[model samples]
Target: MSSRPKAKPHFRVSPAVLGPLGIEQLQDPALAVLELIKNSWDADAKRVKIVVDQRKAPGKILVNDDGHGMALAEFKERWLVIGASYKRALEKSEGGRPLIGEKGLGRLASFALGNTITIQSARESGRSFLADVNWEELSSAASLEEYEVKIRRGAVTNGTRVEIHDLKGAWSSDHTEFLVAHAEFLASVPGERFHISFKVDGKAYRVKHALATINRLAEGSLEMRVAPDGTPTIRKCVINGADEKRIVFRDMKSDELDPTLAGTRLSLKFFRRDEAARRLSGVLQRNEVTEVLERYQGIRVFRDGINVPPYGLNRDDWAGLEQQRTSTGGPTLVPGNSQLVGELHVSKRAQPHLVITAGRSGFADQAAVNALAKYVRWTVRALGTARRAEHLGISEANVRVPARIDEGKDRPRTASPQTIRAALTAISRSEVVRANPALRKKLEDASQAITETLGQSEESLRLYAQLASTGIAATSFSHELRAEFDVVSEAIAEVAASSRKPDKELIDLLSTSWGRILAFAALFKVVPVKIRRHRKTMSVSELRSSAETILGLASPDKVTTELTIPAMRLSIVPAEVDSILLNLVSNSVKAVAESTNRESGRIRVRFEAHGNDLAIHVADNGCGISRSVAQIMFEPLEGKFAEGTGMGLPIVRYIAERYKGAAAIVRPPASGFATEFVVTLRNVVQ
Candidate 1:
């Protein structure tokens, strides 16, 4: 009696709700145009023409395609229906073309460009259906059926034409350029003859599919092609404008089989900033170079020749180029999002799992996307390394040394204690010594003071270098910590915003962040401890083993490292040994990663005793150091590689000199190694 009836509410949505949100979702006009093109593709159109007529009043955008069009009944059931899964129902068109349009919302994107849209479609039956939409009417409609959409039956011959009128805004030059550049992707379908011609103000420009050939404006470029079976062939192209030479590399892994690299063929071009390079690139004027850079800037992902949005956009660093540079603590010559221009060619047929998102901003958030990102990041680094080497050879105006010490005949030399003692002894038995005994004693005391000062001076220089190295290391450490902290902070904030209870995701995030923090803490503990004067007995094998272990912990698991040292003791500071080993290993790792010939790289370290000194040889099978870098390998300057802070080799030299040792580059004794560095250290009594 108390509970006579329970009330139930039915939820209803207005069709006009999407009128505003759909327009807002199309934040990019280029993306809106791309959506229309995708729709044409999904319709199995073999030839599509886009005519941009802005010279006249109101302006107009007409997209005409020769494809299997729609009938009146089908148009009412699917075309006019919002969020219809008609494409998804069949999965493929009648002509066997994969349905590129998933979300029905793409059709609504027309509202972002113009106030009026007319869709005319026809099947192979030589008859057509026409439907016209007034966006204003749809927005003010009280109900879905209230808006009047003009529809006609058997209006035209077999084909589809979309006419957008009353342009919302003017299309800028950048928009046109975007369309021109993206045409290559749109026309890239294999074994299919698809043409997309663009016409503006009665002028026409046809987009070409140029994936099979490359036209790059750089000093050097690396092109990598991976087959479906995971076989890779690498070609290094040296472009001196019209004179281009290509060197093909064989027997390299290329990491094509990696989960992230599956079904992706990479083409990475390296650019140079030198005047010579700019001139060679046919950029005669500064403005011309600017235009070229503007047209071909950023890394783009092309799926079956269609440019996927957001990946290569100005602000999108899908390849993590900036993060990789930051991780290396230096300016990446590997090209940031704004500097490098290339394409990650993927095929929908080959990589079905790499699904595009409904928003069209990028691929869906999944492991495959992450893998693609990782592979791209690695390729960027590799290209940057190669380009940096090429850039070093470009002559500069100033031929001065990077570093100089003031020690010449023109500069007065400071007298040392030994020089003063020798002078005094020369006059000790002479009349000057007898005439002024007090003077002789004063001279001897001054000599002792001078010797102490010189000792202090040496110590000061050593400390200065150590402090400089530490300052650099500290800056990098802080950057890494800040990045980790950002993740942790985000996770904590997410957990706090939860409904008063932590879910499994929140717990996992907390655990992961905490683990990363702990790992960094452990890594920080191994930062080389400066112990210039503190000599300790250390086993060569033990030092190498410890350094390798620390390197293994810090480095990515892909790098292969091997340590070869006899269990012999050396009377030197353990920290210095660690510093030497660490720097060399780090350099080797970078070289290996950058090498196109050796995708999966290896570093080998061997220790040998030479008389009263220890010669530690560190080698790698990476892209070898150029002659220019080799000549100044230990010159106490930043090495001429992109992945370096210009301090790694210098640090090695600094530590070597402190131990009365020397670090030098030598020819590798074997074929397996690309570059070899020998560090000689003096053996002392501990």
Candidate 2:
């Protein structure tokens, strides 16, 4: 047998690969221009200008920068290379600016904007040269080496100029505005000396960073610094300018966080949109402030004072702030994305593991990125807690809730209802409270009420959990039961067809009874399962009709109900609104039935328009609630009535808060009613 000789083969690439590497690498023309500007920044350019000439068809774009330009040899070796980044060996430029381009394909981003690009460079001591490339020609070539770039010597200043011709799409005023906005953001990067200017059709556009103004007008802010070892400290926290306090979190370690997050700093500014508009009225209009917030609301990532793409954009929820806002038990605690703007600062020199994606869309999916997200979420939670404490005039120490309980075992246990009750008892009997008779009495009363409410809540939660489990089984059971019923129905029809008159009548009765039983089973199956609801726009008449139908099914025949709704449309989740009404009306009916002297029971549900908000007034003529009980009525399981589970009002309040509104007991109840509850749905009409 003969042995085969070994052969070596090399990889050859066609110019067609540039389609994905350059033309399709960036879908947006504005983003491609930004990439070119970043290259100028990396070159230590002190001044950069971008001109978009749209006065004629097939317009051209010119980007000029005064920086350290490349010579003929450097251009041929570095600029012509694809995917071989010279920046991989250099951490910073000669002028000490942090290098921004790493993929080496940023120059090719020009292909996304146009087919032809002409580049002219003039070095300080070397001969200036110009190179022209036609992407279409290169793309059609069989191999990368087949395409040629026209080169010529040039007598120009020390800088670089790029002219893109044969535009892919028409540049409109909207595109110019987009570039202008991006330029303002770029210029706003801290510690960056590079300046960028924009011109549309030879008209110079001024850039004003609105973020600076927003930062100044923010109502609440949190600034934190994390050490290399993962120890986080609050540098400054202004919850409310009127009264500020320092908040501290104890025993937190970076063990769970990625070590790459070391030395990361985060600063968040929160704005109550309406309040911010009022404060900025002298400087910016309400709509302008709104537009600014809408454009830049999420937390952005900045590495070495350079803005990263796709993080803070309107559509980006990289930090999951919007998700948290809609998560279970988060509506009241977490602020929506539109209410916040923040910056997460990392360094290329310090946190090297935080690598950017190849496409430059965002950071790579690694432990460091996940750790960054976790840290941001924790910071948001802390800021929210501090803000709430300040607003309520509560001490930061009192606001801290135990996350877990020490069970005197190998593993700590989550705090249970019993543990919370025991802790409340201990608090009421503390020495400080016991020393004062008045305070001691108040504390005892409060503790007792809280204990009772806790018990009721625990019981209700247990039952709801059981019901959810049962619902799963009931769904399957109902299907089978329906099939059996259908068989019985068919058998009855057969018997009626072959029997005498009396026997036929008996069979018909049995079928009707079987049908009623099947209907009951279907109703039973639905009772344990919660309906998933989606928000939809409905007219006033539609909403009214739906409410009436719900009331007819849920309300007692003995009680009279009246609904008054404004003649306007609303966007709401019908199921949520139904839940709110059912709970309120049920409570009122109970109150009326237990009244000492009442000829008739009446419940009035009136919807009133308060500016952009929708106020739902539920009033009833029933045994009135006392000032004391009414004060805590909306609290979970705070109802004092014997037959009440006390969870109804809390559920109502939760739904209201989910809509950025509140549920309150209206004191001095509405005329002709004994007790009144008002649930406001914020901005429902708008």
Candidate 3:
């Protein structure tokens, strides 16, 4: 190698480099305007006004701000320098506001909006100055330094004004509306000291903070705080004007979490977009509320009372809420972006690791960002859990009725005319009633009438319960028998194909299928009668055996079953338990079979006992239930699949309620399973 003395050469930048560094760096014209506003904010501006005039060709836009304007020398040193980092060393402005613009490139954002820019500023105690720049001239120059900005003396003023001409795009009403909407949210909090006004063609556009309006009508509100150690605790949760119990999340102490996510506070307000919720809001029109939510429903991050761009914008799922809800099959158990408006508060000086991206669109991809997302998700989930519990409590309270008195008996008894008459007669003998004989007679007559009405109601309730039970049983039996019949039919068809003698495998398959049919028939026979008898306790192994038998008949050969039963006995009747398992497994089988891309089906059954309550979770890797379907899946004849009788889940729910428990579609466990159903049986574990 003939290596002479290597020459060190410096790279030369072309005037065309401004295209990529300035004009092309920002794609959206509105964002360019936003960058200018941010510069005003960093200058500690209290009032800024933007005027867009399109009455003539090549519209002119003016941005005026009343702030601490720059002196000529200061402007030449900072504003003229490309890629300046002076703001990087400063934490706050002279007015004690946190600095927002640091890269010094935001000034170039004006070139994205127009071809020419004129800036005029006057400092309180320094000389006023004016600077004019033509972007087209700069881009065509031989070198970046060959272009010169014309600087001259300007009228004395206390603030700055930027005049941009030769607009790139036609200005319209929609652009003004976008400015109003986005500018309203820039302050992080509504009605802050920083004020922004917009005027289009001499018409002032009013800025309404939609988030503030929605917050007042929110159905629920939650506030949480995260400690430096990564422990999160709910400070307050109010749902439907009632304070809910607090929820706590485990500490996140990973290497990427603890250092960056300390001392963050989050506040969220929930709005349910439904007619009932709208009626409760009292003043909200359906269309008006919908429009508001569509615009402002997301979680935003704020650093020192100023919003970080693009985090809470429309359709921005920075926290992965939609992904979480889809993975868990839990729209009710997890809140999506459209359901909440939240604010996350962080400090620039405190959490420097949470750096903003180069384009100012969002936070950089870092561990700190992941930690923040995780904490926000946890907060949202806690809110959902509290709201769900509140709903369940309300449902239970609505269905409960006061106990009726019986003749000299402390226990509650069924309503009857004789019992009512006896109780009213005792009341009539009181001194106040004796004094008013006519009133006493009225009371006695009313009691008899009330008792008769209640008795009819009770009879109707009994009939309804019987009908529901019978329907569930019939549906379950049909589902199981169909599977067995299919197995038997397949075995017989195989035997017929041999044409010589029945193979051993085919004979064994037919016998097993027959045995399953008999077992299922016996199980069905005991369902209605065994519910009335004293419940017999069964060991964990016995329950597993029952589940295995049902799974074997319900699942096809390609389907696999996973059981995670703890070593505990349950004080539940075997028949009732069998019915619950039979319906759940059969539904899973159908769901798996209905899936378009079926390889090998998987079903998981897990049991956990908390005190005397047993929680059974049945999950499957199948064609998952949609949120709309899950909402009404427990209702009779409301199934998503065509072959579903829709009575299976209703039956499972009915049996659980008989034992003073509940059945629900819960968030799927984190085992890659979809569509999970939870059946809770109270006082059943021993």
Best candidate, lDDT-wise? 3
- CA RMSD of all predictions: 23.7, 24.6, 21.8
For model 2, how does the per-residue alpha-carbon lDDT over 1-686 read when each residue is reduced to its tens digit?
99898877967789878878776867668777888888888878888989989688788999999989888888999988888888988888888877788878888778889989999997784568999999788888888876888999888568899999999877766567666656666677667666788888889887656877687768888887787668666777776673344544444544765555778899988876545654543333655775677577778888887777767664355665543432312213445455688889998888877778767877786557767877887777767666655655555554553322211336422234465455545544556555657655644554454344333332333334332223211111122122223333333233334432322222222332343233322232223234425677868876776567545422344678888997877887765666676567657766886674244788889988888889988888999888888788777435544333345677777778889999998889989899998999998885
Higher-TM-score candidate of 1 and 2: 2
Best by TM-score, which number? 2
| TM-score per candidate, chains pooled | 0.48, 0.57, 0.55
Winner on lDDT (1 vs 3): 3
Clashing pairs in 3: none
lDDT of 2: 0.66
Error of 1 at 617 (Å): 54
Predicted candidate 3 versus true structure: per-residue lDDT over 1-686, tens digit per residue:
98798888967667677666766767567778888888888787888998888789789889899889888888888888877858899888888787788777788788888999999887883567899999888888887677888999877787788999999877755566556667876654543578888888889976657765687678888898877666777888888887664433333446434545677889998875542233442333544665677577778888876778777765466776644443332324556666778889898787887777657767785566667778888888777766665664432322321111121346343445565445434544556555656655644444444344434323332332344336533234443233343444333333334442432323333343444444443343334343523578798787877777667644455678888898898887776787788788878877887664255888888899899899998888888888888889888656555334456788888889988999998775447777888999999887
Q: Which stretches of candidate 1 lie over 4 Å from their true place?
A: 1-12, 54-57, 89-93, 96-98, 146-148, 201-206, 209-213, 216-261, 271-294, 314-317, 322-341, 346-354, 366-370, 382-686
Q: What is the C-alpha lDDT of each candidate?
A: 0.60, 0.66, 0.68
TM-score of 2: 0.57
For candidate 3, the per-residue lDDT at 559 reads 78
Clashes of each: 3, 0, 0
Q: Ten consecutive residues with minimal summed lDDT in candidate 2?
A: 472-481
